[model samples]
Target: MNATDRLTELFMRFPGIGPKQAKRFVYFLLREHFHFKEQLINALQELKHTGKQCERCYSFFGDKNLKNPKSKCHICLNENRDEKILMIVEKELDLDAIEKTGSYNGQYFILGGVLPPLTEKPSELIRVRELVARIYDDITNDSLEEIIFALPVTDYGDVTKEYLEKTLGQIVGMKNIKMSTLARGLSSGLELEYVDRDTFKSALERRQ
Candidate 1:
């Protein structure tokens, strides 16, 4: 394939992007100044170099000019954040939306993705084992009291949430840990990443 076709194909790989939109993006780039292309390439390269995943929460954060850049992200390093409450999310975008609300001040764990119904080995699809291990470690090492499932309201999200609740509840120490999810303020079929701040705040407040 030619440069234009190859670029469009690559852009189509992004979620929600179709062939027509990807083609538009490619043509838009072609019409832009050469310096703009250079800037975009530089930014993409810098993303990989500057981004670091927090060991504890597994959230990606940029450590641009910090003294100890290898350390955890700001949220995880903050002593004021509630270590006793852990919020589980489907992806980084969901975590970002929750943070934008400024309502939740607890630790977070990104499940990476939700489980698809057709997948035979559902546990292998997401970070299930890692999440369980983290919960166990937190209960033993930290003052973990609650685990909030902050997944989307979709069917797959519900499936993953139920699976986690069942599996985690079976753990000896997890019996006392309070488990909850976002309230019905989040309409069914709406993903957490697209939830408005007011709706997110209300759902968080009414989380059961």
Candidate 2:
């Protein structure tokens, strides 16, 4: 493919970009401020270079202890926070959104991605098994009490949440797992960020 065609193809690979959107982006980059092309390239290159996933919570960032330091992520290391309640999120963006509210004092677990049936094996992409082990480890070792699920409202999100709840229930033997979901007052099909702050806080407070 030509260079323009190649860039269009690359842009299309992004989550919400369609062919037309990709073409517009490429044209804009080429025509509007060509200097930004270098910035884009540098940003993409630096993305991999800067951040490493936290060993404990799996949230990736450019923290000092990201590699092998004694301390974990700030949330994981915060002694004042309640480790007993864990909030599981689909993406780091959603985690950030919730964290901005400053309402939730509990720690978090990031699933990395929602579950999908694209794989032949059900266990392929989703890591509910490891998640379960983490929960059990926390309960027995760290004395955790509840798990709040903050997954999106998509089909994949719903399925993954159900799978986790069922698996944890089976493994822990009883609903000793006080599982909860984002409250329904928030729009049924909206992302966590689109909802207003008041509603988001309300949803968190009324989270079930």
Candidate 3:
């Protein structure tokens, strides 16, 4: 394939980008100024090196003066944020949406992805083991009290939540952690990343 075709193909790999949209992106980039392309390339190249994932919550942050290789993100390191409440989200975008609501002042764990039904060893698909470990660690060390499931309002989200509820319930001492999900303010099939802040806030407030 030529450069244009190869680039379009790569763009198509992005979530929700169809072949036509991907081609449009390629042509748009081709028409952009040389400096724009240079800047985009530079940013993409520096992304991995500049950003580091927090050891505690697994959220990525850009810290130029980071001293420790396993440093926590600002939210995890904050003294005021409630360590007892941990919210589990599917992706960083969902986390961003929740933060924008300004209703939740607690720690978060990004699952990286949602689990689909019939997937063998569902724990391997997302950060289930890591989340379990974190829950235990926080319960023992940080006085964890509750865990909120902030996944999208989709079939996969429900499946993942049910799996977590069942599995985590079996862990010793985890019974004390009050688990809840975002309320019905989120319509069926709605993703947390796309939900309005007001609706998200209402769901958060009504979470049981």
Candidate 4:
């Protein structure tokens, strides 16, 4: 493949860029004299080696933590947060959405992805096991009081939540686990990230 085709292939790998937009971006970079091209190349190269996943949250930050990883993130380490009240979310995006609301002061457990038979591998579900182990280890002989399910308000999200609640619920005990979900206000925002701060805040307040 030629340089233009090569650039198109690279850009297409990005989340939302289509062929037309990728071609336009490549041409723009070419006209701009390749500085952006060099920058993109350098960034991608660094990404291959750096920004490892945090062992605790599974969120990709930088490599320093990966070298000497911590069992908890800054939020998880915070003394003020309610360690007894845990919230399980499907992805980092959902976690960020709740954090932006400033409504929840509890610790978080991210599942990394939902359980969809299409792309959901059983190994990917190990994160849920990690959550169970962490709670058992951290809560001083498994005394966690609450676990809020904050997955997206989708049909798939509902199925995943029920599965988790059943599976982990058995290991952790259904009596100790009080399951709650975000309010309907979040439905208006569809994409959790796009929700306004107030909407998210209200959703948390109305959470049952």
Candidate 5:
């Protein structure tokens, strides 16, 4: 177990990275200049100390947010953004994708993960309890008008959507908040994280 094997194992821990890909990452790092490796190490160290998960959306941020330990992410604090609409995405990457489109002007809530069909103990699988509380608070504030489901177009996505809609509907129904999802403009199995700007825009417009 040398540095190469140790680094490979660490890289393999990242989601979707397999043995071959992780090994390639190690070899690529070895081929790069020492300066690049140093920079990478420094960035990781800074993030380790300063990285903060948003209190509202759970999206990770760093820098100034670390200065105020109780502060929310920039998006959550932005007054110009629409408070009446909330988009629920499965992960941070998916939320990032929507932001890059530059068409959305609403709040976001990251559900953390999608659930597979017939999964047991579903609350343990994602941030279900947290989402309910968030929605309840928003509704209480009279700031929430709609909730958009921006989950991926997959089996896991469908299951998660069904579960959330039913569970959240209880609160939404009493509050009269409309719930919608991204339209079928998204191809089957398409991930919101990978959706292109134009495609996402279309889906958003066609959302029903």
Candidate 6:
């Protein structure tokens, strides 16, 4: 394959990007000046060198966020964050979007991915084991009071939520930990990756 075709294929691997979009991206890049192309290459190289997955929340953080002594991201190491509540989001981007709102002051967990309905191995689709472990540790510390489902409003998101609720219910039994979700402002097919501040705040405030 030519360089353009190879680049298009790589772009197609990005989530939600298809052939047409991938080709468009490659063409756009080809049209851009050499300086812009060099900048993109340098930026990607920097990301490769600096990116680090947060051990606690599984969010993608970088060196700047590693000032803490622990092998954790800045959010996980922040003492002022609410340890009593945890918001579980579908991916790193969703978590970042929530953080950008500056509305939530609680902890977070990135589920990695969502499960489709009736999947035989739901665990393979998300970080279920890690999630359980985190909850247990929280309970042991006597700080866990609630878990909020900040997943998307789509079918896959619904399936994942049901699975988490059923699986985690056993671990949370008699623990008095409240479980909630983003409320009112969300539309039926809303995706947390693109949630607006006002909409997210309303849903968070009205979460049952």
Query: Each model's TM-score, in the order given?
Result: 0.87, 0.78, 0.87, 0.77, 0.94, 0.87
Find the number of clashing residue pairs for candidate 2. 2
Per-residue alpha-carbon lDDT of candidate 6 for residues 13-83, written as tens digits (9 for 90 to 100): 99899999999999999999999999999989888877887788988767644355556788998999999
Each model's C-alpha lDDT? 0.85, 0.76, 0.84, 0.72, 0.90, 0.88
Give each prediction's root-mean-square deviation over alpha carbons: 2.4, 3.3, 2.3, 3.4, 1.5, 2.4
The whole-model C-alpha lDDT of candidate 6 against the native structure comes to: 0.88
Cα RMSD for predicted model 4: 3.4
lDDT, residue 101, candidate 6:
86
| Candidate 2, position 117, lDDT | 37
TM-score of 3: 0.87
Clashing pairs in 3: none
lDDT (10s digit) by residue, model 2, range 137-190: 786675677888888888888878877776687655553667888786645675
> Which candidate leads in lDDT?
5
lDDT of 1: 0.85
Q: Which stretches of candidate 1 lie over 4 Å from their true place?
A: 65-71, 172-175, 186-190
Model 2 lowest lDDT segment of ten: 63-72
Deviation of model 5 at 181, angstroms: 1.1
Which of the numbered candidates is closest to the native, going by highest TM-score? 5
- Residue 130 error, candidate 5, Å: 0.3
Model 2's TM-score against the true structure: 0.78
- State in Å the error of residue 167, model 6: 1.2
Candidate 3 lDDT over residue span 29-142, tens digit each? 999999999999988877766788888788888776746665788898889998888899999998887787787899999998888987788877899899989888886785
Candidate 6 has its poorest 10 consecutive residues by lDDT at: 62-71
Please write out the lDDT profile of model 4 over residues 23-119, one tens digit for every residue.
9998888888577778988897887877566565666654534465464567866788876777887788777777887877987877877776444
